[model samples]
Target: MASAMNSLIPAFTFILALVTRMEKLDLKVQSSQAKSIGTILSITGAYIVVFYQGPPILFSRPLPNLHSFSVSLQSNWIVGGFLLATSSFLISLLYIVQTWIIKDYPAEMVVTLFGCIFVTILSAIVALIVERDPNAWTLKPDVELITIVYSAVFMVSIRSVIYAWVCRIKGPVFVSTFRPLGMAFAVFMGVTFLKDTLHIGSVIGAVTIALGLYAVMWGKANEVQIIEENVISRVDSSSDKVPLLQNKSMEV
Candidate 1:
């Protein structure tokens, strides 16, 4: 469910980019229309994933203990969904801010470092407040420790730097367009490692999100191509004017 919400980041980023005037939208343009449709598809897919959980498809054998937590998941579904949506919104906002910073500073690593530091501090504060059990905070020499180290290094550190660099080069909307790609990995991992039931709605939602992402990518690519062509045309026209101006000055 969280992953489903996360897939909406591209749409959120697109809207934010538009709001910030970093992106232009003309409904008469095919590319802009594609982008708008893509955003709507992504949103529709997310809602389907949240509201409609069709019959579970057999993916893998569930662990014997799987049923124990099903009730808890159902109970907290609304709250978790709300939090996930909020997190997605905040992530989109962060991408916009990161792009703004990178535009001026052009420092990916430095931006990522500061971002990770503040995020860590904020996470720690939240953890301390929510986690009442001291044992939950303790890191043991086991899978938990390994997971923490891996997430800290790869997910937080490396990924942050990569995202920052990409944002600097391609802009945040372009960077965020890949968010739906993670849905495939999330579904695979959940079914394989977690032995979770695969729902038909989830599969449909994931496919819909992927299609929307592709549409958005195609639209963005076309827009870039058009902009480049316009730039080249302007340069050619300006160069032609340059010779005329020079000839006029020489005659004078």
Candidate 2:
């Protein structure tokens, strides 16, 4: 049931992106720029998925069975959840800073510095919490917590900033196409790092996701091209009218 729920998340995200006009559906008018952005996003998503999911399959000996969900969280799950939540919030706050600070500073430098600061703060907080409540904390180090923090700090923060910068230079569609890529990366990372084995159903779902992403990009590219052509044609017609008007005024 958890796996099924997880599998549907990507589809949900894709649907949301489409509804928000963050992606396209046509292919004939797809832009090379969108394709470029999409490729990176896809790769990133793939890597993330593989990392997160692959472990269970690869290390099946230690992992819970697919049908099992009875494992108690105990203190470890609480500590880990707290860490994950805190890290996510910190990363989001940093992302806001990046959105505003990039206007005045080099985005890459700002993001990198913020990332370092976040790591330091996160470490300090974890240490303090553990020190204060040693007995209350989990005995095991939370790998999930660590992974979430890393993903938010590096993947979410850096990628979002890069996408924003790219959109400013190129266009929105170019950056929007990356949504699919991010999904792909998540899937890939889950499988690879977590040792999650992909069944035929998962593979089929992934392929469908790929196709949907392509459709969205293609539609966006067509829309952009059509708008550009219309603007140019209007400008040309206006320019020709101006010359004609000047000639008529001179004769009068």
- Please, what are the lDDT tens digits per residue for candidate 1 over residues 35-97? 777777766666566677799886677787766754433467788889998999999999999
Model 2: how far residue 120 lies from native, Å: 6.6
Model 1: how far residue 205 lies from native, Å: 1.9
Error of 2 at 205 (Å): 0.7
Model 2 Cα RMSD, 1 decimal? 9.2
For all candidates in order, the CA lDDT equals 0.82, 0.52
| Candidate 2 residue-pair clash tally | 48
Write candidate 2's Cα lDDT for 1-252 as tens digits. 223223333333334434555445443544534453444444344434433433232332324575566766465756665565455344333334443455456556556566658776998798887788666455345886688778877776776567557544434434444444555565567577665555443454456547546754674556668879999999989877757778899999
Indicate the worst ten consecutive residues by lDDT in candidate 2.
53-62
> Model 1, residue 200: displacement in angstroms?
3.3
